[model samples]
Each structure stands twice: as C-alpha cells, then as structure tokens.
Target: MKHYYFFLVFLLFTSCQHFEKQVPSEKELLQKELKAINWKEVDEYPSFKDCDKLGNKTQRQQCFFEYLAQLIQEKLSIDTLSILYPELDTIEVKVTIFPNAKMKFEPQFPKDSVAYDTIKIDSILNARLVDFPKVNPAIKRGIPVKTQFILPVIIKVE
Candidate 1:
C-alpha cells in the first residue's frame, strides 16, 4: 500500500504541467518594447534663437514662425527692386536645416526672365548664411533631427 501511494504522488506531480511557467521569447519582448513607444509624435520641437524663451509649446511655435519671417524679410527686401518695376511677383524660399544646423536653400521664382536676377538672389542668400546663427534642430528620442521651412517673401504691387 505504501509503495502504491508513493508512485501515485510521483505521477500526479510529474503529469501536471499547469504550474509550469513559460518563458517569453526575445522577439515577443522586442515587439512589446516597440509597441510602448508612440512613433507618431516627436519628443520635442525645433527651436530658433530667442524663440526658446517661450514656456508654452504654442507660443514657442508662433515665435519660431515670426522669427523666420522677420529674418527672411530683413534679408530679402524688395524696396530697391520694386522701384524698377511697378509690380513684382512673390518669391517662395524653402530652407532645410540638417541636424548639424547646416542650411540648404531653394528659391522658387518665375521661370521667365523678370526684373530680379536669380544670381543676385543666390548671392544675397549666401551672404546671409554666413551671418546666420546656428538654429537648434528638432529632437526625436533624444536625438537631433532635420527640419524644413517655407518662407514666402511677399512684395505688394503698390
């Protein structure tokens, strides 16, 4: 009887796999880690000099736009060119800043020959770049990122 009871207890313990813990695989753990991060959003927005003083994100964004507008307007004024032609079309400039704060500019103007020379525009932009202060690039996951901005240099016909 004692031998039979010992055998029965041993069998019961070995046959029951319900208490066994299944270890998770590395792939499963990696999937869970990826899911925890929100890929749609950035950790922080890009900053320009004097714009970072604002405490709120909304204000900071507004300041950034204002700063860029002022900087471009100050650099490329049509006051001298407007006198030559009674009317002039607006110029659209796209500036992209890399993570290292290096700038690349793309100026879009009328394809046809106009009063303003593209070469002069290039020289003006290049000259301003030499004096431009380094901007703080956007941040993602504690890493610096590239940012692009479009600035419209609007000149009134009047």
Candidate 2:
C-alpha cells in the first residue's frame, strides 16, 4: 500500500510539472502582435459612400482614387490655373485624409522648376478644394487610420 501511494503521488507530481507553462507577459504579447501586423498595407483603404460597397480591396481602392481625381479635376477646371500656366500639363497634389474624415490637399512643385508661381497655385488649390463629399477613413485592425497619397492631376485647356 505504501509503494502504491508513493507511485501515485510521483505520477501526480510529474504530470503537474509537465503542464506548468511560463505564460508570456502582457508587454511581450503586445510586441509579438505588433510584429505580426503588416505596417505598409492597410486592411481597408479610405473610401467614399459609392466606394464602400465594392467587394474586392483593389477595386475599392481604385474606385476611390478615380472618384477623387475626377472631383479635383472638376473643381480646378473653373479656376485660372490653366490660363496662368498653359505650359504646365500636370500637377502632383498630395492628399491627406484624416481619421476624422477631414481632407487636405497640397500641390507638389519641383524644386528647380520656377515656371509657375507656387504661392498662387497653393492658394488656388486651398480655396478651390473644399466641400468634398463624406469620406470614410482607412481601416487597420478594425481601427480608423489617416492615409496620404500623391495624385497627378492633368490641366486640360480647351
């Protein structure tokens, strides 16, 4: 009976030891999760009301970009940018969309290029680019995030 009791106790002790695992700390778990996430790509791109219904990620992104470009082109068409800078064919505009759905547009000019007045273009863009439709911010891990991209807008003179 004594030997049997000792064997049972020994088995219990060994089994408990095998089950004991060192649980990682909260900070360590968070670090591991962050490392696993891809920082370069967003799970969902910033979208408009018309763009949100698209099933594919790439198609949704493309629709959003094209819609934005068309809006910009339409707004700037009435402005005097084309008349002032007829030689300038296209302008690169840096667009930033905030999580709060606010948008900012800034014109990107080449450093060495002095053909057009930068201040005039900046003011025109700031004044013209307003009252845009509601934009849903980008999503990453179910959280809204700010996104920025440069878009080339063509200045067509009729």
Candidate 3:
C-alpha cells in the first residue's frame, strides 16, 4: 500500500505544467515606444537670454517671446520705415531660428497690394540679432531642434 501511494504522488508531480516566458523583440519594442511619443511638440521651447531664468515652461516661453520682441523693437527703426512707407504701419513677421542660430525672416504685409523695402526690413531684423544673446535651441526627445515664431509689429504715429 505504501509503494502504491508513493507511485501516485510521483505521477501527480510529473503531470504538473510549466510555461516558457514570452519576450518582445527589439524592433517591436522600439516601434511601440516611438508611437507613444508626441511628435508634434518639442520637449522644451527655445531659450533666449533671460528666458532661462524662468522656472515654468509657459513663463519661459512668454519671456522668450517678449525678450525677442523687445530686442527686435530696439534694433528696428520702425518709425523710419513707417515714415518712408506710410502704408506699412503694421506687419506680421515669421521668424525661423535654426539650431545653429541662423535665421530666416518672412514678412506678411497688411495686404497683397502693399509694397515696401522688404530687404531693408530683413536686414534690420538680422542686424538686431547681434544685441540678442546666443539662444538655446528647442529640444525634442533630448535633441536640440529648430523652431518658428510669428511676431506682429505695430507702429503708431503717436
């Protein structure tokens, strides 16, 4: 009877199941991670001079825009431009700052019919950059990146 009990116990133990672990491949893991990231947004906005002192992201961004605008305003002879061409009192300029600190400026005038010295405006904007400190480029996924900003400049006769 004891021998029979021992044989039954051995059979039960042998019948128990075991499973092999399933592991994901490197490609599969990478694809999943890439899809989870926010491609449309940067991890951090570009930093300009004093903007780095701001603690919050929103405030930093605001300070960057303000500082850049102020710098441009100081450098730009808007009054002269307006005086030369009264029609160009307000303009919307799109500025693209590359990771290398290179810039491209595109001005959107009030209307298609307006004509002005665009080259001079562009040159003025470029020259003003000298006063502005070297910028810390935007970051996406820990990599430095470039960004674009649309700034509006309004000149009043007052």
Misplaced by over 4 Å in model 2 are 1-5
In the order shown, what is each candidate's alpha-carbon RMSD? 5.0, 1.5, 4.2
List the candidates' TM-scores in order.
Answer: 0.64, 0.93, 0.72
lDDT (Cα atoms) of all candidates against the true structure: 0.72, 0.93, 0.74
Candidate 1 segments whose C-alpha is farther than 4 A from its true place: 1-41, 78-86, 110-120, 155-158
| lDDT per residue as tens, model 2, 42-113 | 999999999989999999999999999999999998988999888888999999999999999999999987
Which candidate gets the maximum TM-score versus the true structure?
A: 2
Model 3, range 1-158, lDDT digits (tens) per residue?
99999999997788664444668999999999999998878888988767888899999988988877766665555436656767666667787888887666676655554366667766655655454578888888888888887888665554
Off by over 4 Å in 3: 1-21, 117-131, 156-158
In model 2, what are the clashing residue pairs, if there are any?
none
Rank ordering of all candidates by lDDT, starting from the highest? 2, 3, 1
What ranking of all candidate models by TM-score puts the best one first? 2, 3, 1
Model 1, range 1-158, lDDT digits (tens) per residue? 99999999999999888778999999999999889987655566667878888899888877877777676666556445445544655667888878897877777776885766778766666665356666787787898887776777664544
